[model samples]
Structures are given as structure tokens and as C-alpha cells.
Target: MRIQFMLNGSSETVDAEADTRLINVLRERYHLIGTHASCYSGECGSCIVLINGEIFHSCMTPLFRVRGMRVTTIEGFAKQHAYKEVLAGFREAGLSPCRFCAAGRILTTHALLEISPNPGEEEIAEYYRAVKCRCTDFRTYLKAVQYTGRLRRNRHRVS
Candidate 1:
């Protein structure tokens, strides 16, 4: 099948089998290694991606399901060049031990923040729970939420 969609920010075409998984096409066919697939079972959240503004684990998602949907991977965020603050927060806190999980978490958190400007601790915890990082620790994740919150709060300060 010839798949056509917007990738990162550009329109592109991909030739893939009808039943091929999105992550496989992305990582193998397209060579977009930024979209890492860890569990390949859609439970790890390592292969999570934003497809047309909603989140989905690309590992189990089929290419046909995303034929016309816009795809956003870690590479897109890196290219758009807007992941500085949150990324730095995770970095300063040394959250890079499991780099595969970092990008998905940050992307998910960023997307959630877009909808809820000031997400409470409970909300953050709930969202973080859906993503199973290696550590299973919420302390650092909460700290990351706080860190991103500070940046968001400061950005819209009314003075």
C-alpha cells in the first residue's frame, strides 16, 4: 500500500504492507529511529506517538489506520525545536537512565499541559500512570511535572 501523510511537518509517502505496524514502517521502512519500539506490545509506552493530536502506541497501530493522519514523533519535536524547558528539567533531574521512555513521557506531558494549563498533582499522576516507565517511581515524575509547571506558569505570567 502507498501511504500518504504528514510526517514531523512534511508530507510524505510510504510503501508498506496492509498489515504492517506503524512502528515497523516508521522505524524500519522510514528509518525514523526516533520512534523507538521497546515492548512492541503497546504496553510499555516506549513507542507512543501523537497521531493527529491524539496519543497511540505505534507498535500495535497499523499503517492503514494512520493513512491520512498526521504523525508526530520525537524527531518532529526536536526539529520544531520547542522541547527545551521540559527536556532540560528531565535532564537536570537525571531522567535519562531510560532514554527510550523519556521522549514519550515528555511528549505526553507536553500534550496534556496544552489542554490543562495547570494540571494538579493527581492529574499528573494519573497521566503518568498510563505510561509504564522502567522505574515505576512517581517522585521524579512529579518533580518533572512541577518543573514543567513552573515554565508554563512563568510563560503566561500577567505581571
Candidate 2:
């Protein structure tokens, strides 16, 4: 199938099979390897991507299903947060995922921040649940979210 859509922030077209998983297509064909696939199923959020501005597990999403939609991967959304800020937050919290899980974790946090710039504990749990994290428990990740929110808020107030 010939799929056309907005990737990141630009129009993109790629040839894909009807049943081809979006994760494979993105990583292999499109070469957007930043959208990692660990579980090869929706159970792991490693293959998560922003489909039409909402996070979706790409491993379960067929390319044909997202033909006309916009898909944003980690590289795109991660840029929303300063690289140093994310790295420092991860280091300070003593919770960094292995390279395989980093992309999804980063993007998940980015999406949560986009929705709730200052989410509370419950809200953070709800968002983190969707990612199905394997490295860090919700507690450490929650701290990162809180830190991210504070950073964003502080930046906003300063601006």
C-alpha cells in the first residue's frame, strides 16, 4: 500500500504492506528507528508513537490503518524538552532506562507534559500506566514528571 501522511512535522510517503506493523515500517523502511520496538506487541510502550497528536502503540497499529494520519516519534517530540533537562532529570532521579527503552519513556513523558503541564500524582500514574514501563517503577518516573512539570512551569513563568 502507498501511505501518505505527515511524519514529524512534514509530509511523508512510504510503501507498506497491508498487515505491516507501523513499528517495523517506521524503523526499517522509513528509517525512523527512534521508535523502538521491544515487545513487538502493544504490551510494551517501546513502539509508541504520536498518531494524530495522541500516543498509540505502533506495534499494534497497521500501516494502512494510519495511512492518512500524522505520526510523531521520539526524535520529534523529545525535542520539545531540552535534551540536557531530560538527561539531568533521569540522572538526578537515578532512573534511566536501557537504550532500548529510552525513546518510548522519553516520548511518553513528553506527551504527558503536553497534556498536563503540571499533573499531580494521580494524573502522573494514569499517564505512566499507558507506557508500561519495565525499568523504573512509577515512583521514580513520577518524580521525573514532577521535575519536568516544574521546569516547564518555571520556564513559562520566566518567559
Name the best candidate (by lDDT).
2
Candidate 2 ranges with C-alpha deviation above 4 Å: 81-84
Q: How well is each residue in 28-94 modelled by candidate 2, as lDDT tens digits?
A: 8778887877887687787889888678899999888787888888777656555456666667677
Cα-based lDDT at residue 103, candidate 1: 66
Candidate 2 accuracy as TM-score: 0.86
Q: At residue 43, give the lDDT of candidate 2.
A: 79
Per-residue lDDT of candidate 1, residues 77-157 (tens digit):
776534776776566655653676766787777777777767888988877865787764787877776777677778679
Q: Which numbered prediction scores highest in TM-score against the true structure? A: 1
Per-model TM-score, in order, reads 0.86, 0.86
